[model samples]
Target: MRLKSALSKVFASFVVKGIEKWKFDAVAAQERTLKKLVNEASHTVFGVDHRFVEIKNYEDFKARVPVRDYEDLKPYIERVVAGEADILWKDKPEYLAKTSGTTSGVKYIPISKQSMPEHIKAARNALLTYIHETGNASFVDGKLIFLQGSPVLAKKNGINVGRLSGIVAHLVPAYLQKNRMPSYQTNCIEDWEQKVDAIVEETINEDMRLISGIPPWVQMYFDKLTEKSGGKQIKDIFKNFQLFVYGGVNFEPYRAKIEASIGKKIAAIETYPASEGFIAYQDSQTEKGLLLLADAGMFYEFIPSEEYYNEKPTRLSLAEVELDKNYALILNTNAGLWGYSIGDTIKFISLNPYKIVVTGRIKHFISAFGEHVIGEEVEHALLSVANEEGIEITEFTVAPQVNPTFGELPYHEWFVEFVKAPVDLSAFALKVDKALQLKNIYYFDLIEGNILRSLKITILQKDAFVNYMKSEGKLGGQNKVPRLSNDRKLAEGLERYIA
Candidate 1:
């Protein structure tokens, strides 16, 4: 334990130094990284098309390469999938990270040898930063369980393909693998239920010091652990458990429930990692935002949320962003994704050291009646109502109910799964409606003008989301229910599960 503590201190110090160096002069660091990326990919097809050689500065680069979404780059990505070389990056990608799509059936994101190291480095730094901030280095001495997807990868066009989490699992450092839980054999089980069971059976008695995963799924793991250990809380089952690392989804809704399940307070670390690149991580224990990884192998652009849907949105670089404004994120990465829009929206909360909070998604919103309600508004409203009403909700989704066949005017329909159901369902719905109106001016106007009917709420049966994701073959890792949609696709699909 003494030796482990000493090593952890050394690791923490090293990470602090690295972070300091990267953040020394944020603008300068980003400029250097951008220059390096442009120079490295200058020989690629994309670079040639965009006239990379003539680009002398950020303005030149922006003027040449227009921002693009996954659909916009589909043609180029298709060529890469067909084993084409030097199309987007200098060389073909080493692997493709597959993510679920809303419009497209699936998205294949390239992961090059150069970018893989960036992902690994960012993850390591996130943990080490946590240790440095909290002085909790003892976690390294014990097991750390990460609820990841199956590591079994598939081949596509002779390139490896799989979920990002699964890919990262295969790349775990050799030394840390000794302290990682849920043996490789267990992680390979594709079925989430069986995998969780195997994990519980294997690690119930182990010296678990840390756990990491999406909050909802991690909550599921905690539930299973408690059940298997005869109703003891997770903290009782794993006495040394110290940290809970989460990413991929908003952790606010699940925070209270998870804390209750654990029966003790544990430090939580939040990260913002997309298949495109590792973006940010919670760097300070007291601060409420994630510090942007400015020098990672990616260049970033932000289009103000208000202008995001415009034909030609104004793109701002890191040095141009303002504090507390939502912006759609765009990226140029070493992994062959250039000027790519990842669809997520974020707001800068601090600028000196550069920190942000992910607000919502560009494609995930309800504007059918010009209410223009985004995921951020819905999440805020839900959390506000949940707190005010003393209710605990596990999962939820909102969609428009617009068909006249139902003999009612159009309204927003909500499907909610509650861990602690509200005593007065009608009052709960009313409270949520009022909260939404408060959050969105257009929504309020629509309701006041009687253009849209009152919102409708439907309680979902237990594990409704889990079952829905299971039916879609996306049961566990990184999959989440979209909070708001302009149409009824998701809501209608989940109708059968409504209680």
Candidate 2:
């Protein structure tokens, strides 16, 4: 075995053993984390304002700090950005993870010195867990690429500001530096398409074994590779490629088309990472869910998805979460975010090790006529039919059509970009509609009671999602198209690209 591969095995064994200690006693670990975070931040501006000193337990913490989104926390964040110290956390944050926002224009999430290590460790441990579980450390000896944002960072009030992925790029371990591709100069390109082109030029002939990114961006990279190589499969281009590490979106929707482009099925690791924290990762190949990071520097809370918008939603800790129920995930992190809502909804699949699957975004859902359809349900419904019928979906999104151009009942409108279109499009759409109705009962009732017509599918031209994302200036680097939207903003924008 190569030196790096042997070292990876030893390191992975150690990491996995450490993780196992916290896996079973997750509740205890979370209790300790909450206590530590509250105690540490008691003197900070936000902590003092929220009376964190009196927060002796989860109930007290809940009473002291209410769930807040970026907008609600913007006051403190602005203070921090203006060179304020001891505001959110004990001291000024080391970095600000800048992200585009819906109403706020731009969001700057603090990454404190204390909390930043957890982010790096979680990502490393994810790989270590994979190595430990599968005994596949050979990928360590080969080239690995993470399709990400430019590593070039801007400064805000003497603090580094960049995308989370770009921030992570600077933190990659020195040991992996030689194995990592493409070069720093190539990674510094700001334009995503141009960056991918540069990446293809740099790494096309290298022995690539592991590729990591959000699925859509990785798909674009694969497309570029094939086009450049005159339609050769990715597996043909990189014969030793074995592992795909991805996060930000569910891999299932892109699995068929992605694997087809690669020309083979390969091992994949699903991770649940966010600017707020590294939440979870697939701990086992045989497991159905990602293992929640209880020992991480964040205290987690969950409110039932149905009660999310209520005056006072029921907030439950890790101990109180039940299996298979949708909940809007809330966070209180050492980075000094108190009762922060990252907007993602998740479902616990295992209570034992606290495993979860991201269900949808709290704001990204369709409830046009009381049929509250989530991202997971729609993706599941559509992908089920597609997989069963041997059709390949490149991308899809759904929105409710409240008003029709003609004298027809309103219905759910699905805009789909397919790699392989079904032979009978109408029948295929009906089958998918049936599958969705099964997943969400309210949707079934709406269809049965004639409140809404059956869902309609609008075939989209190739690269429709790409074009739409580009128009929105969200073409790459952790930008994901919502599977279902409560409004027609995304749907109407995509209409221009309809086939």
Candidate 3:
């Protein structure tokens, strides 16, 4: 334990120094990263097509290559999948991360040997930075559990294919494996519930000091742990558990319930990692936003969210981004993704250190009645209502319900699965409706003009969202409920389980 603690301290010190140096000249660091990435891939098809050899700076690169989404890159990706080399990067990717697609069945994102360091190193640094910031080196002495996807990877044209978490799992350092719980066999369980059961059986009595996963799944694990431990809270079972490192979904809604389940407040660390790359992580205990990794093997571009859907949106380089504006993130990475849209939106909170808060997804919003409401707004409104009403929401989704018959006005329908139901359901609905109106002026106008009727709140049965996710074969890992949808597909699909 002493040796491990000493080693963790040394590593944490190194990471902190590295982060400080990187942030010392954030703009210069990003410019250097872009240059290196472009120069390395200069001979590739994409690089050559985009005049990479002549591209000496950010402006040149942007002028040469258009911003692309998954669909735009599909042709190049498909060619690579078919055994072609030097399509996007200098060589074919060693792995392909399959993600739940936004507009399609699935998205296969390339992952190269060169790109692996950014994902792995950034994640390691995030944890180490947290340890350094909080002086929690003892966390290294005890077991740390990462509730992730199966480690069993599939192959596609000789390339490993699986969830990014699963791929990263297979790459866990040998030293850390000693303190990591629930062996590979348990992690490889295909069924999420079965895997959670196996994990609980294996680590219920272990010296667990750290836990990492999406908030919803972690909450599920805590629930199971509490049930099996004769109703004992997680803190009672794992007395040493001190930190929760989570990503994939906003942790705000789950915070209250998760804290209650643990029976105490534990330090939490948040990360922003996507199939595209590991972008940022919470670097300060005092700050409320994540610090963008300027030296990570990716160059970032930001398009203002409001202007992104315009015919031609302005793209800003890292140095040009303004504070507190919602920007659609674009990436040009060593992994071979060039000028790619990751679909997530973020608002810069700090300029000197480049800190940001993820606002929402680009496509995840409702504007059916020209009352545009993004995921961030919906979440904020719901959170406000939850706090005021003294309720705990397990999960929720909202959709616009356009009346099929004449003489009926369209309205927003909210499906909420609560951990603790409010005393007055109608009053809770009224609060949420009023909160939404306050958040979006267009929504208020629609309500006032009778273009949209009052919001309807349907309290879902327990685990309705879970059941919905299970039905969709996405009950675990990185899958999450879209807070708001422009159409009725998700809302109608979840309606069946409404209480």
Candidate 4:
């Protein structure tokens, strides 16, 4: 083996051993993490304001700090952006991750020097865990590509401000710099389509081994490569490709299409990373959940997702979580985020080691007529039916159509772009509708009571989602269409692309 490859194996082994230290005692790890975070930030502006110094335990911490979203936390973040030090953390943030928000417009999330490494470490551990499990470290010898935003950052009061992926671009370890692609100049291109073209141009003939990105963007790259190569599949162009690492959206809905594009199956790792913190990662290839990062520099809290909008919801510590219950994740981190809701929903699948699966987004749900429908339900409904029927879809989204044509009852509208159309579209729609009913009791009750009609599927033209995202200026880099929406905005916008 080459020197770098040998070193990678050694490092992967070391990391896995470190993981074992706290993997079994996750509850204690989280307690230690919370205590450390609170004690370290006790003298900071937010800490002082929230009485962090007086917090002795989780109950005390919760009593002092209320869970807040980006809008609620904007004032403190604004102060940080204006050159205020120790407002949210112990000192000035090392960088600000800029992201678009629905209600708040643009949002800035701080990343402290102490907390940034946790993000890098969790990602590294995910890969190293794979190596330790399968003894496959040969990919380190080949080229790797991560589809992400530009690394070029703008300044916000002396703080480097950019997308989280872009900021992460500057932190690729020295040992892997030579193996990473597309060139910094190519990645810096703001136009996503042009950047993909440049990436394809640069990577087409290389010994590419690992591809990482949000699945949709990677699919776009594969499409370009296939088109440019006169219909040759991705595997033909890059035979050494062995792993697909993705996050930001559930992969099951896109699995068939992605595998078809690649012309074969490959191992994949899913990570749960957010602007607030790196939360969880797939620790075992055979396991269904991501291991929650209990020992990371962040403390966690959970609110039952159903009660999230209640005046006062039940908040649970790691020790209090139950299996298979969906909760809105909250964070208190070394980065100075205290009781911050990141807007994502997750369900604990394992308690002993604290493993979780991303269920959906707190805001991305369709409760238009009292029948709440979440992302997990919609995805399970669609993918279960599609997989059963062997139908392949390129992309899809769901929205409530409260006002239908003439006297028709309100119904869920599915906008789907299919690679393989079903033999009977109406039958396919009914199957998905029934599948969803089985998953959500409220939806089932609504349908049975005639409060809502069966879901409807609207066939979309090729690249309809791509066009919609481009029109909205969210073409790539961690941007994904919400799987469920409560209103008709997305449905109305998608009307133009009806096939």
Per-residue C-alpha lDDT of model 3 across residues 372-417, encoded as one tens digit per residue: 7888888888899798667898888899888746677888888989
Query: Model 1, range 279-354, lDDT digits (tens) per residue?
Result: 9999878989998989888889999988987888898999999998889999999998988989999999888888
Model 2 per-residue lDDT at 78: 96
Encode model 4's per-residue lDDT on 54-157: one tens digit a residue: 99999999899999998898899899999899899977999999999989998899999998999999988999999889888889899999999999999988
lDDT ranking, best first: 2, 4, 3, 1
After superposition, candidate 3 runs with Cα above 4 Å error: 404-406
Q: Is 2 or 4 the stronger prediction by lDDT?
A: 2
lDDT tens digits, residue span 1-499, model 2: 8999999999999888899898999999999999999999999999899898998999999898989999999999999999899999988999999888877898999999998999999999989999998998999999999998888999999999999999999999999999999999999988888899999999999999999999999999999999999999999999999999999998999999899999999999999889989999998998889999999999999999999999999999999889899999999898889899999999998989889999889998999899999999999999999989999999999999999878899999999999968989999999999999999999999999999999999999999999999988898988988888888888889999999
TM-score of each: 0.97, 0.99, 0.97, 0.99
In candidate 3, which residue pairs get closer than 3 Å at backbone N, Cα or C atoms, i.e. clash? none
Candidate 1: TM-score?
0.97
- The lDDT leader among the candidates is 2
- What RMSD does each model have against the real structure? 1.5, 0.8, 1.4, 0.8
Query: Could you tell me the lDDT of residue 232 within candidate 3?
Result: 100
Give model 4's clash tally: 0
> Which regions in candidate 2 have their CA more than 4 angstroms from the true location?
none
Number of the candidate with higher lDDT, 3 or 4:
4
